[model samples]
Target: MDGDVENAPLTDEQVSDQWKRLADLINKLQARTDTKDEFNARPGSSLTGDDAWSPPFHVSHAVNACIVAGADHLHACKTLVVDAHSLHVAAPASLIRGSLENMAAAFWMLHPTSRAERVTRCLRWQMVNAKNARRALAPLDLKDPASYDERIATILEVAQRHPEIDIAAVKRGFTSTAAVTYADEHSGAALGVLLPWQLCSGFAHGFTWANLAFSERVEIPTADPDVFSVRFSTDLTRALYLVWAATNLTESVLKLHAQRSTPQY
Candidate 1:
């Protein structure tokens, strides 16, 4: 049986083809939206009234966002694959890590209780963004005091509207590591995702261990009596792993959405 046979290793051409196929799938998925209108309009659909605030609706929306984000990262990886000679493995690996983290969060948020916590975390995130934007505009405001008044006002409004987020707590909760842990607790794929997350996180953070993995020594001969140039060539394995993981995560998100959308008759 085919299942009994061990799989052969993929050749370079086969890997390239897989990348192209993944890119195509991402493009198709990105064209879709998560609104009720789109879902109810599908052929043989039975959705009648709006379930906008329901758990399934919210879950579907989060999954759709995850799909779009995953597609973007997949496309980026595809571009890097096409230009393998100049590939910077860390760049796409970082993006892939981000996409996976988002997927994990989406899955984690699918539960009834987690949905409210997700909202709180979102508000906390927005608060951080607003604070950062205000700080960035602080200097510009010196040139024209009114230049960023509206922007500052908007940030303040958000802060006033939402219950104050404990900045330290929020920081602790929203880290990539924390997201992965949440996934491990809620999403079944966490065990598979943890190591990759750690590997990519090291790269993204410029850890010595991660950098060493990509480093290669190359010597360039000089015309002068005794001069030489040495440079490092990055291994493409990280990038390949990133692309593969992204494709799998995208497919998982799509399947989750499909299962959620199906009528429970």
Candidate 2:
């Protein structure tokens, strides 16, 4: 069935039927309301110590982002299933890539060392925001310079409170390359996740190769656009793989949160 979908040029009816199957599978997976609830719940702090588990602000934020990404991926998949246009499908491919990347980051942050790295990254992120705020404060004749000054002051005040965050050190330590490398070393799924990510990125960036999806060769030349109708065919195997990957990442994140929530006896 999967081979037929991938190899044969499907009719409009076949395309609709395949889309229905894909939508049904997504719906079935999404029906696990309890899991989704647990995912959204406030995560506990520590896993094994006498101290009560209280998730830090960053940990909570990461979990929230992961959950949101999962939902976004599902939504994108559903949208593409219905639309099935070459241009429209690129949006979901891009979304899935982003979701996978976020999952990878969350996985790395679950570890102690990686968590520290993430903290440094957060500090650097704040620094970048401050820098941008400063740039916005640049005097412009049309814009009110005083208003920019007030915003810049507010940002600077916040920055002063975190005097311990060495911007240079944080910049040096918080690299995405290092994070992905760490994930690869530990989880062993980095490459598998990244391969699809790269492929999707090609489509997102509007590369020539990606545009080949819209190309069709016909033995008989036809002037009518409808003569060679190009309806996007659903790749069941790819859809199933995406669903499985999203579910796996979701489970891993939830398990991590649960592990941290429970204290060791």
Candidate 3:
């Protein structure tokens, strides 16, 4: 059974269908309105307690951007391939790893009961991005904080305004791996998400353990040289599992955003 299973072809219609579903999810991003979301006009929707501010839109924008970024990474993973695609092992996994992170971050940012909690998560996510941007700005004025520093400072001030959140307790940077694990646990996916995500991370980063685990290998043991010659090939089953996990995670993000963005009325 094991030999036959190993030799069996990896052709399946389900993987193709999942890709189509992901494409559909990406299309929904366009339907969302930028100017008019009815969030501000709706009563009792003011989580910030200021009629001028729209927490839903402010928070959703970053979260949705994550979805869009994830879509780009996933789209780069073209199903169509020609010629020698042997180097495909690391590429798709790398792309899916990105997709997983985006989906997880979006889910984590929006997956809170209180609007303050959601806003705090968004602030943290943006704080990390701002700090990264500040680093990229070379020769940053050390004597006086630059605009990026001011931006982060403003975010910290905002974080302190909410009584529900403790700024001192929160970390400066968001952890994508923990977010991915949390998202997968709540995603209701048939297959495990964190394992696939970690496997992808490992494979994408050129980790030796992932190399043997993800690829098909035929080895020749040499006693004289105390060495072994090995050949590695693509493992389609594992590839399909990655696709399955991405599909579920992306779908969950889209669904959650749709539900959260729409007004109760």
Candidates by TM-score, descending order = 3, 1, 2
38 Cα displacement, candidate 2 (Å):
3.8
lDDT of 3: 0.65
State the lDDT of candidate 1 residue by residue for 1-265, as single tens digits.
0011116766777666665666666555545532334422132222111122222223344444555565666566666655454577477668777777776654544432333344444433334444566577667755464545554354344334335423344443345566566655544442256666776778789775765565565778989858877565564444655656555555555554454456545
Question: Comparing candidate 1 with candidate 3, which one achieves the higher TM-score?
Answer: 3
**lDDT of every predicted structure (CA atoms):** 0.52, 0.49, 0.65
Tens-digit lDDT track of model 2 for 38-61 = 444332334222111212324445
lDDT of 3 by residue, 1-265 (tens): 0011223444656445544554554444333323355222233333323212334336756776787777766655544221133337778789889988998898887777677677777777877887778787635565344677777777777767668764753446678887888887887655556988898899788886777887878888878577898766675455656766776677677666656665554
Which run of 10 residues does model 2 get worst, by summed lDDT?
47-56
Task: Give me the displacement of residue 163 in model 3, in angstroms.
Answer: 1.7
Q: Given candidate 2, what's the lDDT at residue 101?
A: 61
- Model 1 worst lDDT window (10 residues): 41-50
Over 4 Å off in model 3, which ranges? 1-57, 79-87, 139-145, 169-171, 221-225
Spell out the clash pairs found in candidate 3: none
Kindly provide the TM-score of model 1 when superposed on the true structure, using C-alpha atoms: 0.59
Candidate 1 differs from the real structure by a C-alpha RMSD in angstroms, to one decimal, of 7.2
Model 2 misplaced regions, further than 4 Å: 1-37, 40-44, 47-57, 82-89, 113-118, 121-169, 172-185, 188-191, 210-234
